[model samples]
Target: MMRKFFLVVTTWLTVSTLFLGSMVMADTYWIDVREADEFATGHHPEAVNIPYESIGERIGEVTGEKHADIRVYCRSGKRSGVAKATLESLGFTQVINEGGVEDVLSKIAAEK
Candidate 1:
């Protein structure tokens, strides 16, 4: 009986660790780096608006750590590129420039 209990507990811990590890690896953040008016027209369901100019001041709303996986987009690629550079300069490790809003929309659709 003691041997069986220890075996079950070990198995449970292994399974639980695998499940929780996947959850952490799956975390991602989407941001829109356009003006308020432009973002009001359309944006990704998972995206949060924080215009390019304010990224330095408001990026904490997305994440405080420098190792977060963040995806940023805008009306055009220009602003998003600026945001990516700004984030990288701030010590971010994984800031992806997701191009324009339309580009990101098309990319998501293609993935589906």
Candidate 2:
């Protein structure tokens, strides 16, 4: 009984580790939920702005067929938070709320 319990625990641990690791390895994309003008005012080089109000209608177009991890942001962070939840509800593997565009841009600038 002790041996079986140990084996089961080990198996469970291994499977959990692998599952978590794969989740961490998922691809991430920067999705800007700001308006076109805001997005144009210096954004992440690779970010795609679909705007918060338009996200539901444009999610499929922006996301494409391939699964991608998403980092969402807006002018004030509020929209991005909502967008993150929406993306999660829509089945995105990893949707990160990156807060406001200015904050993110500053962080990126600082990193360089």
Best candidate according to TM-score: 1
Q: Tell me the tens digit of each residue's lDDT in model 2 across 12-112.
A: 99999999978866656788998899888878898888988877778887665335777899988999988887776777756778898888989999999
Per-residue accuracy of model 1 over 23-68 as CA lDDT, tens digit each: 8757789999999999899898899999999998999997887877
Clashes of 1: 0
Which number leads on lDDT?
1
Give all candidate RMSDs, comma-separated: 3.0, 5.1
What would the TM-score be for candidate 2 when compared with the true structure?
0.69
Candidate 1 TM-score to native: 0.78
Error of 1 at 47 (Å): 0.4
| Model 1 regions more than 4 Å off | 1-22
- Candidate 2 lDDT (Cα, whole model)? 0.82
